[model samples]
Target chain A: MELIIDRLTKQYKNKIAVDRISLTLNKGVYGLLGANGSGKTTLMRMLCGVLKPTSGEVKFNGIDVSQEEYRDSLGYLPQDFGYYPEFTAYEFLLYMASLKGLAKQSAKDKAKELLELVSLSDSAKKKIKTYSGGMKQRLGIAQAILNNPKILILDEPTAGLDPKERVRFRNLISQLGTDRIILLSTHIVSDIENIAGMILIMKDGQIVHKGGLDEIIKAIDGRVFECTVDAGEAGKLISMHTITNFRQENDKTFLRLICDKSPCENAISVKATLEDLYLYYFKEVNTDEKLF
Target chain B: MDNNIKRKLKSVFEAPMPAKKDDFLNQLDYPKASRLDFIKSQAGYIRKQVWVLSLLLFIGTLILMYYFEVSDSVIWILSSALPFISLVSIGEIFRSITYNMDELEMSCKHNFLEISLIRFGILGLANLAVLISLLILLAGKTDFGFFRLGLYLTTPYLLNCYGSIFAVNRLKNREIVYVCGVVTASVSILNALFTTQINDIYTDKYWSFWIISFIILAVFSYKEILKLIKKMEELKWSLSLTV
Candidate 1:
C-alpha cells in the first residue's frame, strides 16, 4: 500500500511546529532523523490523524487519515505513551487489541503471541507498573504492530532500549519493513544508519534532506575533515567550525569538524557518515549525546 | 503404551487440528469489534475499586435502614451520597486523556470518543442499577412515595453527571471534572439538607415543581450529553494541534 502526505502543515499560535511537508511512502523502512522539537512528533502525529493539519491532508491508498478505514490500516507509537499501571502486560495488549477492533479470542491469541515475541512471555501476567522502561518500550512496539497495519509510525521507539535490546528491535523492525510502510523517528543515528532504506532529515520544522542513505551522505562529501593539532589550535578550530568529535591525545588534539573548506593546516578529508551530515545541518543543536 | 494409545485415540477424536497452527495468522482480518463487544471490552478497564466502594456504600446504607426508623430525611441523605460513586467513573473517562494516551487512542480504529462514551455508558448503567435498588429498598420502608423516591435519587446523580460531562467537554484541562463534581455534589447535599421534611415533598404544590424541575434537568442533560460527544469527536483532532 502507498501513503501520501500532501503539503502537511501544523501551526501553533505564534510558531509553526511543522512546516509544509509533502512526501509519499511505500513498503519499506524510512528513518526520520531530527533533533528534539524539530517537528518529527508533529509530523508523525499528523500522519496518524492524531493532530490535524492546518492546510493539507494525509491519505493512504486514497483513504483520508481521519477516516476509520485509514486508521484500520495504520499503527502508531507516540514518543510519550501512557499505560494503565494496573493492567498486566497481557491485559494491556489485549485491551489495545480490542481498541484496534480485534475480536476477543483473536485479541487474546495475538496478545500472547506478541508477549512472546517481545520476550515478555515470562512477565505476561505481571502488572505494567512492574516493567522496566525498556520492557515498556517493547510492549509499545508490540502494540503498534498488533493490527499488522499497512502503515506503521513509531516516534522514538528505541529511546529507552539498551544496546542489545536496540539491536533486537532493529532486527524486528527490519523484518516487518519488507511488507509495510514503517516510518521511525529517532535522534539516535546508529538506530537507523544500518536499517533504513531512506532517511528524511528534519531541521527547524522542515525536511532539509530526504533520499537514500548514501545519497544524503553525499551532501556532506569533502566537507568532513579530521585533523590533529595543538590543544590551543584545536580550541580555535572548534570555535571556527562545527566540531562533531574531539579528543585529546598527549599534547595534541584530534577533531572531526564539518566545514566548507579546510579549517586548519594539515586537515585530512574523511568519509562522511550520517552523524556528520546531521551535525552539518543542525549546527547549533547538540544531537551527539543522543547517539548510541 | 496405554497412555500413548489413549493420546492417539483422543487426537483422532479431536477436530482435525483446526487446520494449520498458523491458520489464525492468515485469518487475521482487520480487527473490527461490534458496539456490544466494544462496550464489554471497555468495561474491563473500569476501576474495580469503584464497584467495591459502591457495594460497600450500598451495604452500609442497608444496615442503617434495617436498624433505624427509615424516613424521608434518611433517604434524602443517602441519595446525596450516591454521586460520589459516579465521581470515580467520571475520573476513569478522562484517565487516558489526562495521562497522555489521548493521541494514541485517537489514532486507534475505534477512536477516543467511542471508548469514552462506552465507559460513560457502563458507569451510567451501573449508577442506574444502584439507584433502582435503593429506590426499591426505601419505597416500602419509608413514608416517601414513588415520585419522591425517584426524584430524590435521580437529582444528585444527574446533576453530577451533567456537570462533569459539561466541564470535561468545555475545558482543556482534565482536572476540571473533579471541580465540577465537587460543586455538583455539594449543591446536591445542601439541597437535600434544606428539603428534609417528607410533608414538604408530599404536597401537590412542591411535587409539581419538583417534577417540572426534573424534566428540565433531564432535557438539559440529554442535550449536553450529545454536545459532549460531539465535542469529544472534534477535540480528538484539534486538541493536540493547539498550543
Candidate 2:
C-alpha cells in the first residue's frame, strides 16, 4: 500500500502553517522531527483530514483523504486530545469503534483485544479521567488502531511518557510500524533514533532533511568532539561551538559539541548522534541551507 | 534462561501462528456501519438530562392543557416550553467541542459532518414528535384547524432554536449551555408577553400573521441550521479562534 501527500499547504491570515510539501510513503515508520511551531502538527492534522488545507491534497492509494473511503483505512492521534469525563476506557473505545464503522459485536471484540494489547485491560472499566497521562496515551493508541488502519499518523505520541512507558510506547510503535505506513512526529530526538526507519527533519514549515539515520548522521560525523576543560575554557567552548550537552564535575566541565573540527587542543573527535544533529540545527543559529 | 522457559519459548516459536492477514482483516468489517446505524448511535450521546427534561416538559404540557380550554393559551404554553426541547439539545449535541474531543472525532471514518447532521436530524425528529403530540392533545379544544395549531406551536420553537444555535455557533466554552438557556428563557418570556399583552395576537384574528411568521421563522431556522453545519465543517477555524 502507498500513501501520497501531494503539495499540501495550510495558510492562516498572517502566516503559512504548512508550506507546499509532498511525500510518498510505503509501509514503514517515518519520524518527522521538528521543534514547536515547525508545522509538524499542522501537517499531520491535514493528513488526518481534520483540518482543511489552503491548497493541495493527501491520498491513500488513489482515494483522496477527504473521502470516507480513505479514512476507513486511516488512523490518527493528535498531540492533544481529551475524552468525555464520564466514559470509561472501555466505553470510550467502543465509541471510537462505532465512529470507525465497526459492527457492535466487532467493536466490542476489538475494544477488548486492544485494551489487552495496550496493557490496559485491568483498567478498562476505570473512567478515563482517572488514568495517568501514559495510560490515557495508550488508550489513544488503542482507539486509533481499532479498525486496523493502513496509515497511522501520531503527532508527539511519546511527549509525556515516563522512561518505562516511553520504552513500551516505542516497542508498540515499532511493532505496529512493520505493516503500516506509520508517520510519527516528535521533537524528542531519541524517540526517532530508537523507533523510526526513516527520519524527516522539519524546520520553519519545510522539510529541511530526509534520510535514514546513517545518511542523516553523516552531516556531523567526525565533526562531534568532547573534552574536559577548566570552567573558564568550558565557557569559551560553549559560546564558540554548538554544544549538544554539557556538565560540570568538580572544577572541570565536560562538553559534547558539534563543530567543523575539534575546537580545543586536547579535544578528541567522537561519533556523532542524532541529538547532536538536532541541536546543531535547532539550538544553533546558523541560517545556512546545509549544515557545515 | 531457565530450561523450562527456554523449552516453552522454543515450542511457541516452532508453532508460529499462521498469517491469515486477509481472513483476520475481513473479520473487522470496518465499512459495515451504515448511516442508519450511526444515526441510531447518536441519540445515546445526547445527555441524559436533555431527555429527562424533555419528558418532564411534555408531561407538564399535558397537565397544563387540562386547565386551559383556550386554544391560544394551549398553543402559547406548548410553544414556549417545547422550544427548550430544541434549546438544550443544541447545547448537549455539540458538547464534543467543549470537551475537546471533536478533533479526534473529525478524523474517524464517519467524521464530524456526518455525525453533526445525524445528531441534529435525530433531535429534530424528536422535537417534531413532541410538537405533533401536543397538537393532537389540544385538537378538540381549538376552533382553528390542526394545521394552524401546528404553525403556532412550531413558530416559537423555531425562534428559540434559531437563537440558541446562532449563539452556540458564535460563542465558545462550556458556558454555551447557559447562553442557550438564556435564549430559551427570552423566547419563552416574549411568547408569554405576546400571549397576554396583545389580547388577540394568538386568537383567530391573527392566524394569518402566525402563518406568515411561522413560514419566515422556519426559513430563518433552516438557514441557521445550514450555517451551523457549515461552521461545524470548518472546525479548525473555530478551534484556532479559541487557541
Candidate 3:
C-alpha cells in the first residue's frame, strides 16, 4: 500500500500552487500542516485525481492516479464540499455509496453503520442543511470512508468541529490509520498533534518540513524561549526575533518567541511544541503587538 | 449437548434467518453497480424535479400537438417550440456545478466525466423519448408524411441540442446552462420568425437538402458530445480550478 507522488507540480495564472513535491506514503496517519493557500488543497486534489497536475504524476502501488483502478482505491474529502441540502444524512451517504459502486443493499447497510459510527444515526433522517457545521463535517468524514478506501485524503477535516467532536474525530481517524494511508491537512496544530504519526509542513507551494513530530520540531527546538521583560526590552526583542505570542502583565511584557539565541538575560529556553514549530514555519512574524 | 436439541434448533429456524434473507438474494442478483448499471440506478437518485419538469414539458408538447392543425401559423409556432422540450433536459445534465456538489462528486470512483456522461446519457435519452413520442403522435395526425413531419421538428431539436452542448463545452460556471437556454430559445425564435422562408423550402423539393443537413447535424452533435467528454477529462467540470 504505497502512494508514490513524483515531482508533482501545478501552476495557475499568477502563482504556482504546488511545485516539485514528491512523497511516498504508506499505511499511517500523515498530518499536512500549512497555512491557507499553501498548496495543501491543491496537492490533495491531484492525489484524488479530481484535478490534473500540470506536471509529474501520482500513483498507488503502480497504477497512475488518472486511472479508474487507482481512483477505486482512493477516497477524498475536500476542504469545501457541498451536499444536496434537501438530502437526509442517510440519503446522502447512500448517494455517495452508489457513486463508489457499492451495491444498493450493501450501500444501505454501510450508510447505517457509518452514521452510527459518526454518532449521527439518530439524525440520519434529518435534512443536511439543518445540521450544524460539526455535524456536516462528520458527515463529510463518513462519506470519505464509505468505500473502505486504501488511500484516504481529508483536507481540513476538522475545520468546524467543536472540542468534543474534534476529539471524537481524532480517535476515529487513529483507528482508521492502522492499515490505510490517511493524510489530513489543517492549520489547527492541535488537531494532528496527538493522532498523526507524521507531519508535513507546506509553505509557499512547497514542503519545507516533514517528519515525525519530534523530528520536525528539531528545526527550531532550542531556538524557542519564553521571557517576561519590561516594555522597553520587549520592543527591542520583537525587532530581533519571531514572536509566536505575546501578552502584557502589569508593567512587564510576556513573550513566547523563536530565535537563534536568547534576546534577553531573563529569557529561558522552553521545549518547542508542534504549535511552536508550526507558528515558526507559518507566516513570518509581523510583530504587531502593542505594549503602550 | 444433545442430538435432539440440535434437531429442535434446526427445526426452529433460529440464527435470525440470515439477517435480511431477501436482501441477500437481491444482492446476489444485483452485483455492485458500476459504469452503465450504476448509472441506471442513479436515475432514481437524481433530483425528482428533473423528471417531473421533463414530464410536464412533454405534456405541454402534447397539448400543442392537440392544437397543431389550427392553422399554418399555429403549426409553425408548435414546430418552433419543439426544441424547448429537449432543451428542458440540458440544464439538468450539468446541475452538479450549479449546486456546488461537483467537488464531492468529481472524486468518486466513476470520476466526473463518467458521471456527467451518465447524466448526459439519461437526459439525452429522455429528450429523445419525448421527441419520438411527439413524432409518433404527429405521424398520423399531420398533413405531412412521417419523414417530412420529422424534418420540421427534428431540425430545430437538433439545432437546440448542438447549440446547448456547444455552450457547455465553450463556457464556464453555473451559468453555462442558462446560456444553453438562451441560445436554444434564440434558435427557436429565429426559426419562428422566418416561417415564410422555411415554408418555401417545403414548397420546393428540398428532400436532398433536408436529409443531408439532418445527417450532418446528427454527426456533429455526436462529435460535440465526445469533445465535451474529452474536455471534462482534463478540466473535470471545475472552472474555478486552473488546469
Report the poorest 10 consecutive residues by lDDT, candidate 1 chain B.
B234-243
lDDT of 3 at A197: 98
> What's the DockQ for every one of the candidates?
0.53, 0.54, 0.45
Candidates 1 and 3 compared: the better one by lDDT is 1
Identify the leading candidate in terms of DockQ. Answer: 2
Candidate 2 versus the native: TM-score? 0.90
Best by TM-score: 2
Ranking by TM-score: 2, 3, 1
User: In model 3 chain A, where is the ten-residue run with the lowest total lDDT?
Assistant: A283-292
Q: Write the per-residue lDDT of candidate 2 for residues A1-292, one digit (tens) a residue.
A: 8998889988878888789898899989999998777888888888988888889999899999889998889889988898888899999998998889988888998899999988999999999989998899889988988899899999888877788988988998888887789999987889999999999999888888999999999988999998999998998987788888789889899999888877889999988899889888787444342465
Better of 2 and 3 by lDDT: 2
Q: For residues B9-33, could you state the per-residue lDDT of candidate 1 as single tens digits?
A: 8888865556654445544575567
Q: What is the interface RMSD of candidate 3, in Å?
A: 3.7
Query: What would the DockQ be for model 1?
Result: 0.53
Q: Rank the candidates by DockQ, best first.
A: 2, 1, 3
Candidate 3 docks with a DockQ of: 0.45
* Candidate 1 per-residue C-alpha lDDT over A69-91 given as tens digits, one digit per residue, 9 for 90 to 100: 99989889988788876789898
Whichever of 1 and 3 has more TM-score, that candidate is 3
